[model samples]
Target: MKAVEYRLPKEFDKSFIVFTERGTYFPCPWHYHPEYEFVLVNRSTGRRMVGDHIGYFDEGDLVFMGPALPHVWVNDAAYVQGQAKEEASAVVVHFVEDFLGKNFLSLPELEPLKKVLDLSKRGLVITGKTKKEINRRINGMIGESGLRRLSSLFTIFDILTHSSEYQPLASPSYMQHTQGYYSDRFSKITDYILRNFQHEISLNEVASEANMATTTFCNFFKEHYRMTFVEYLNTIRIGHVCKLLADSDENVVNIAYECGFNNLANFNRQFKRLKGMSPSEYRKTLELQSA
Candidate 1:
């Protein structure tokens, strides 16, 4: 699918830009650009799309996305419908790879930092102690100025470089192919899917959305997303299930149906296939972590 290219605000004269976002919802479409982005979701609950990966994210979601890695954070329907608080917030940092100077990362002493940057090409989700530390540093940068702000940014990078509490978001083979004619077409298809996935989605309807035949649409989707359309739909549904499992005491069968699954057996199978655990097991893990 095609993604929109987003241009970051260019008012900052420094090597990087840092800002805080507070809104009723995360306001961005599926998009990509040439900046390396480090974002911490201080508040919000939703699904995050990174490259071809679809998953759930909540408060304390810290992600480092390398240049041109397409991503977006879509708030749940509650936030969009104003049922939840209107003040969804985040701390975001955007910069180029050579923001420190072209030769900076090339230095032998900066090899570890370089490795972090390279690995971030697939997108990185910082977690555990590393995420907590980076969250503090990011919040600190919101008030600092001049060199102090820059120092806090570097401290985040150093911690990320040294810590193993992170996971890659996208596959190595995933690429942003949304250039020229296919851009809007892809965005329309993905948007429709994300909006209507809770109901019965017919391949015929989605193929028509792309102005392609069913066979052609299937081939095109698999080529670009590396999965069949049904697989991608299930990924999104399972992501929603995860958010409910962590945030609510909803019944598993109820959540499955609410997430658009038709039956418990199928939902359990797909959940286990994608997440490597049964729904109860996954919920237990979350409980253990919180305890």
Candidate 2:
């Protein structure tokens, strides 16, 4: 279950890359790379996992991710099972942080852009007018060539830098803890946890996977993830529970056990703790959104 390191397609002659993906569903697993990424989910709805943040993402979803942040958009079960009539599609832009130049972002004129890039370390979801404009620019970029494409990219960045309609997805603590430890072992551990979180998991077993003693593993996980193993596990589980609550008609009790909570009370407590609402309330919120 180790996360595969994704090597994005790079053209030696180009400074950045833009592409569109259309599929039955997003096929990549939990993975990360060194390039910054801006993604527009043109069509589809699903669970999106970025760093330690988990939530629902839908059509018109716009997210900007900094270098080395692990993420994936897992289309809902209906999309995967071909129950949905439309295919999933997205436009993704990838570039290095210094794609302009090593010192360009350090210039006084570009200071605001630098701040936007820094905030993107936690992942940024653009909304309101900015998202609509950026989406238009992204579509335009798909048809541009040479300097026009780069111009559109910079324009999008300028809008994002000036707009106040962006939300940071992950906690600052989560970003701080995970920034410097981009090793194979860390990737493997995350991959294992993401794949197995729906079932019972034990620290001892995970520690064995990392070849560390239980105590050492616990400390290591806390140091890097800024949360105890169990807390992180529950965060992931509750995230899935939120998705099911929003997207399906399954009973809350069944969803609770299906998401790995052993009992109703614990599920309700953890759901409230993480989301600040009961599962039923959260579902009602979704209904309101749909209405």
TM-score of each: 0.62, 0.64
Model 2: which residue pairs collide?
none
Q: Looking at model 1, how many pairs of residues clash?
A: 1
Please write out the lDDT profile of model 1 over residues 187-228, one tens digit for every residue. Answer: 788777767877999999999999999999999999976799
Superposed model 2: Cα runs more than 4 Å off: 177-271, 275-291
Worst 10 residues of 1 by lDDT: 173-182
lDDT of candidate 1 at residue 285, scale 0 to 100: 55
- The Cα local distance difference test for each model comes to 0.80, 0.81
lDDT of 2 by residue, 1-291 (tens): 123478887777789989898999888776788888999999899978776566789999999999877778888888888888899999999999788789877789887787788778879999999999999999788888888888999899889878999987864434543333346787677767777887999998889888899999999999987799999888778867766775589999999998899988988999888876788887775554333
- Candidate 2 lDDT for residue 259: 83
